[model samples]
Target: MAEKVVMAMSGGVDSSVGAYLLKKQGYDVIGVTMQIWQDEKRCDIEDKGGCCGLSAVEDARKVCADLDIPFYVFNFKQIFKDKVINYFIDEYYLGRTPNPCIACNKHVKWEALLARALFMEAQYIATGHYAKITELKNGRYALQMDFNNPKDQTYALYGLTQFQLKHTLMPLSGIEKDEVRSIAKEIGLKVFNKPDSQEICFISDNNYGGFIEEEGGKKILPGNFVNTDGDIIGKHKGIVHYTVGQRKGLGIAFGKPMFVKEINPLTNEVVLSENKELFSEGLMASDINYMAVESVKEPMEAYAKIRYSHKPVLSEITAQGENILCKFKESQRAVTPGQAAVFYDKDGNILCGGVIERAV
Candidate 1:
């Protein structure tokens, strides 16, 4: 009997084509769309650059019908709210910027969906994430960057557990983004040209502050903008409206250029300094998940990515008590708290990752 695979179709060209690819690979593919959007009209589906909406369900259903495969809609709204949305609000409230997509991929996509697939007797769950799963020489599963795919997603996916990686399938690991689109087009998929989802899917206008207030039921209060010396320079908007290294929208003008150097949730202070102060030699991270190894007993050479858009930098990794320390060879800029710090080996295999707690 063929192995059963659940393909997560997000109604985009990548995942749509991913479903087609899985079927052609001789697996019994079942198409599934995660219903993460709320019942109320919180976002514009057509304008969404990412995924999740009524349209996503219909699109996935169409793709499954075309492939002669079964389709299902999984109600993941409660879990999403608990794991992704609430976590986002809590982090911002605590004066740290959070990546909801990363949280969604970990809690919703893998943890929740993988559990559901297993209950249904499915052998594996798959997504169109532009990453490759590989077993290291140490017999541990880890994610590798697909250099062929321009939109590499290994950063957001570094938190995947070993079990999740073992049971997950990425059919597009070696496929380029353009080729995925071409396959969708050749197969007559309507989402072949659909725009990719960019901003937070639930936040249409990207007003994170307003969304946090509405959903979190707490208003983000105004705070003080302070210099590195602890002197208050100006009154500013709420802390949630700003992040480390933010220069624009400060609504205050110093004599020269200035940037957000840090944020203190305890005192509700948004620290400002010259652009140079944003650079840091190292960062302290917590809640780390190891991928290619069981643990890091000593400092090791690796490449560290502080955020999604950042190019990886040469770094040394060490375990400091329950947290991890990433000391970069060259000082990096805007080492923000609440963002992920993903460490990769020399060959670009994910070593481990953790939530950045603070810059050292």
Candidate 2:
């Protein structure tokens, strides 16, 4: 019998092509779409940039039928709300920004669905993430950048464990986005020209503040917008509506441009300051997960990326007590709390990553 592999299909060209490629490679492919978020009354099937909906489920089923593969839609809505959505709202309420995609990839797809694949006797579980996993000389697995794909998703996969890396497969690693769509077209997949999802999967309209308020069951009260020196300058709509490095919509006619320097949930104060205050020389991160190696025993030089789209900057990292401290060679702008700071080697290998607790 052929080895069985489970593919996480998102009803997009990337995943559809991924399934086609894996099936062609002689594996028994099973397509699974996660029903992560669905509120039939409120969610519109025609939403511009959502990943999960009635339409996406239908599209995945159609692709699976065309490929003659078995398809399944597992309901993960409650788990998503408990793990990813709750964390997102809690982070914002605690005066920090959170990346829900990272949490979803970690807790939902890799953990929950990987276990499901194991139950089905599947040898490996795969996704269309633009990343690669290669074996190191030490017989360990390393997550590396996908050079052929411009949109690198290694940042989101940083939470994956070593065991998960060994069992996971990313078929889209060596292929470019445009070429993936081309392959889907060539294979006669109906979603060959589907647009990529841009917004968060759960937030249909992209109103993050509104979603937080509605789901979290708490109203964000207006807070005082103060300067760094504790001088009240203006009133903010709410703490959840602002983030670090935000420069607009302050509703304050300050003489010059002012940015959100910090958010104080304790005193309900949003600190506004000049643009220069947003830059930080370093950051402190906790919940570190290392890859390509077991742990960081000494201070090592590496390139660090503060945000998903930011370019990697040179930095030196040292293992502190229960946390890691990253000192950049130069000041990095808007090193926000609760966002990930992923470290990488010169060869584009993911060293490790952690949550930003504070700016140094």
Candidate 3:
């Protein structure tokens, strides 16, 4: 009998093609769409953004029907709200910029969705994530860079646990985005030409501050924008409205362009500084997850990415108790706290990753 595999279909070209590929591979493939949130305003259907909305569900259903696979819609709204959304808000409230995609992968897609797949007796769970899983000699799984587009490779998948990695598969790992689109078109999937959803799915307009206000019921107050010398240059709408390295939409005019340096929530202050001040030499990361090996014993040289779109920089990493400190060979800019710092080996294998704690 063929092994049963559950594919997490998100109604995107990558996922639609993922299902098609898995089905063709002779796996007992079943398509599962996670209903993570509801469209309260009903405006997102027209917006063509936000994933996990009603339209995404409809699209996933259509693809499953076309693939002749059993479709299942798992309502993970409560889990998503508690794990991903709440964590995002809490991190921002604490003067840190959280990557919701990393949290969603760690908490929702891998933990919650994988558990649902296991409950359905699936031997493996698959997704459209642009990551590769490789089995090592010691019966462990390691995440490798996707063969498609190195720039689009998802190193954030380093957070995936050994068990999750062992049972998970990424069909889009070997194929480029254009090839995935072509396959989806060949399969006549409805979302073949659909644009990728870039923003947080729960946030309709990408107004994170507005979402926080609506959910938390706390009105963020106006704050003073100060320079490095502690001189108040102007007033900001709120501290939450600003982030490190933000230059546009400051609503403040200075002699020269100024960027947001830091947000002091306790004092309700947004610090502005020159673009050069944003660069940092190193950062500390906590809550590290190691999939390739047990732990980093000696200081190892590797490439590290401070953000999702950031190019991996040469760095030397050391494990300090529960935290890992990464010192880059050169200064990096906007190394935000709560964002993940994923490490990779010389050959592009993901070493490990963790959340940025502080920049030194």
Candidate 4:
């Protein structure tokens, strides 16, 4: 009997093609779409507006039918709200910018969804993520970037444990997105030409501030904009409306260009300063997950990325109490709080990653 593999289908080209490839490879494939959110005001899933909508569910069902595989929808709305949505709101309220996608990958896809796949006695769970996993000696695994996809998603998957990596299969690791679409077209899948969903799966109109206030039930109050010298320059709309390194929408004209240097949620103050002040020498991160090595015993040189789009910079990381301190070789700008600081080896393999707690 062939091994059963549960495929996480998002009703998009990548996952649609992923299902097709798995079935063709002769695995007893099962397609599963997660119904994570269903808010009419935010996202109309019935209209195929977002990943979790009824439209996406139907599209995934059609693809499974075409491939002659079993299809199912798992309702993860409550778990998603508790884990990802609440965490997003809490981070923003604490004057930090959280990466919801990373949180969803850690708490939703790999955690809750993986558990469900195991419950069905599936040997492995697969997704369309453009990342690769290679098992080293003695059951150790390492996550690496997919060369075919320039938009590497390994940063979002740093939280994956060895157990999860062992049971996970990513079919699109070596396939480019365009090639995935081509395969989808050849396979006659309807979602072959579906435009990629850009917004957060749960946010309706991409109005993050509005959605946070409405759904999170948190009242973001107005505050004062202060400069580096501790002088009040102007009043801000709300502290939550701004982030570090932002310059354009301050609504204050200081004659010289200024950027958001810091945000103090407790004082309800947004600190403005010259663009040069945004650069930092280093940062401290917590909640670290290791992939390449068991642990860092001493200070060592590595390449680190503060955000998803940031180019990895040479750095020296050392253990600091319960957190890891990363000192960049050169100053880095806008090392925002609540963002991930992923460490990589020289060969572009993910070493370990953690939540950035503070800029040093």
Winning candidate number (TM-score): 1
Over 4 Å off in model 2, which ranges? 40-45
In candidate 1, stretches whose alpha carbon ends up further than 4 angstroms from where it belongs are none
Error of 3 at 205 (Å): 1.6
Off by over 4 Å in 4: 44-49, 137-139
- Candidates 2 and 4 compared: the better one by TM-score is 2
Please give the ranking of all candidate structures by lDDT, highest first, separated by commas: 1, 2, 4, 3
Better candidate by TM-score, 1 or 3: 1
Q: Score every model by TM-score.
A: 0.98, 0.97, 0.96, 0.96
Model 3: lDDT to the true structure: 0.83
Find the number of clashing residue pairs for candidate 4. 3
Candidate 4 per-residue lDDT, tens place, 1-360, comes to: 998999998877788888788888888899999988755556755443467777788878888888888999999998889999999988889999899999899888989988999999999999988888987664579898653467578888999998999899888887777888888888788788887767687876666777788777867798899988889999998776778899988897989999999989999999999988899999999999988888878997889999888888999999887789999999999999999999988877777899999899
Model 3 Cα lDDT, one tens digit per residue, 33-93:
8888777463274355446877888888998999999998989989888988889888878
User: Per-residue CA lDDT of candidate 2, range 221-324, in tens?
Assistant: 99899999999889988899888998977777988999998999999999988888889999999999888777889998888999888888999999998788
Q: What is the lDDT of residue 297 in candidate 4?
A: 82
Clashing pairs in 4: 42-204, 45-53, 45-54
The whole-model lDDT of each prediction reads: 0.90, 0.88, 0.83, 0.86
Ten-residue region with minimum lDDT total, candidate 4:
40-49
User: Which residue pairs clash within candidate 3?
Assistant: none
Candidate 3 similarity to native, TM-score: 0.96
Residue 93 accuracy (lDDT) in model 3: 82
TM-score of 4: 0.96
Candidate 1 lands at a TM-score of: 0.98
